[model samples]
Target: MSYLEFLGQYGDRILSGTLVTVLLTVLSSVLAIAIALVTGLMRLSPNAVLRGIATVYIEIFRGTSLLVQLYWIFYVLPLFGVTLEKFTAGFVAVGMNLGAYGAELVRGAILSVPRGQWEAALALNMTPARRMIRVILPQAVLIMLPGWGNLLIELLKGTALVALIAVADLMFQVKQINGTTFLSAETFGTALIIYYVIARFMITPFMRWLERAMQRKLGRA
Candidate 1:
């Protein structure tokens, strides 16, 4: 079939899949961000026990392959009685796995904040919680924004793997249509274009805007 004909037949399904992809990306990004924050902060904790736990968490997730993690979440977890829906499993695995990596980014960003900032906060007798909320995290955010933005795009691309576990994301939809119609190049090519559009026009620009806004907010501009 011609590409237009293929699209006419499957465009809506693909669009729906694209929307699912975006939704999953957004949801996972939120989860990843939250995880990054918590674990990242834990990395700075003075308590050796807490710091060790956070360090192990980050290392375990980061040390393993994401595909293995996804499969374990989807396939093995059910065996352990922790059942998750396909979408939920995909989101959790992707968010958590990426969050482990993001934790390093957060930890580094927090550490990169001038040592004077911490000393100044302590000198002012700011409470630990207040210091994190008011003094440290804000400054770290500007540095973290760029790294997290890149991770967001990685999350977007990573959603494709969800299809392996039966999530009806863009890649899954494309596979289904391609299997039935034998329109390999057309379906996949369109999927590629759609992802490109999202990454280029939507995700990239949004990340850039976010980074710039953060820099301005932090007065680094």
Candidate 2:
């Protein structure tokens, strides 16, 4: 079939799959961001216990393979009666894996803030929380925006892995269509274009806009 004919025949299904891909990427990004912030803060905590716990989490997640983590969450966890749906397992695994990486970004960004900022907060008798919220994070987040933007694209690409566990994402649907039609070039090529459009047109623009907004807020624009 011609490419247009193929799209006409399977467009609805592909659209559905793209929507799922977008949803999964968005939810996973949110989860990953939250995890990064928490663990990243914990890594810098004065309390040794918090630091230790954060270190262990970062090490275990970063040390392991993401595919293995997915399988363990979907398969092994059920053995212990902590069952998760396929979609949940997919996003959670992706989020956790990326979050481990993002945590380091956060830690580094926070550290990149001038040491004088911390002392200024201390001089003002600011609590640790207030200092982070008021002074440190505002600066650190600027450094973080560029890294997080890169991570967002990585997360988008990583969503393809969810197809292995049978989430009906774009790649999963492409595989299904290709299996039936045997149009390897058309099917796979279309999928590639779709992913690129998302990352290039949608995700990239949004991240740039977000960075600009944050910069404006900080009077750095």
Candidate 3:
């Protein structure tokens, strides 16, 4: 079949897969950011225990391959009597892997906030929590935007790996359509175009908007 015919027949399936990919990206990114914030703050905490726990989490995820982590969560965990649905396992693994990288970004951003700001907050008699919430994080978020934007793009790309776990994401559907139609070039090329469209038109623009909004909020735009 011609590429146009293939698309006419399989377009809905491809679009469905794209929606699943988008859902995975959205869910995993949110989880990753939450994990990054908590663990990054813990890594900087005065308490030795919190620091140690965060250190272990960051090192373990960063040290290992993401595919290995995903397989462990999906396949290996079942042997230990812990079973997760494929979607959940995939999202958790991707979130955890990216969260490790994001933790360092968060830490660096927080540290980039000038010492004078911390001192000013302290001088104002603000509690540590209040200092972070009211003074420190706002400044740090602006600094972190560029790094976070990159990570978000990485996370979107990484969603392709979930197809291996039978998640029926865009990549998975591409494979299915290619196998049945024997139109590998058309199927895979279209998948590539879709991914590029998502990253270029959707994710990048949104992140840029967010950066501008944050800058405006900070009176720095």
Rank by lDDT (best first): 3, 2, 1
Q: Model 3, 106-218: lDDT tens per residue?
A: 99999999999999999999999999999999999999998998999899988899999999999999999888878888999999999999999999899899999999999
Considering only N, C-alpha and C atoms within 3 Å, which residue pairs clash in candidate 1? Answer: none
Instruction: Write model 1 residue lDDT over 121-165, tens digit each, in one string.
Output: 999999989998899999999888888878888888888999999
The models' CA-based lDDT, in order, is 0.91, 0.94, 0.95
lDDT of 2: 0.94
Candidate 2 off by > 4 Å: none
Model 1 lDDT, residue 96, Cα:
95
TM-score of each: 0.96, 0.98, 0.98
lDDT of each residue in 33-95, candidate 2, tens digit only: 999999999999999999999999999999998889998999999999999999999999999
- Give the least accurate 10-residue stretch of model 3, judged by summed lDDT: 1-10
Identify the leading candidate in terms of lDDT: 3
| Per-prediction CA RMSD (Å) | 1.1, 0.9, 0.8
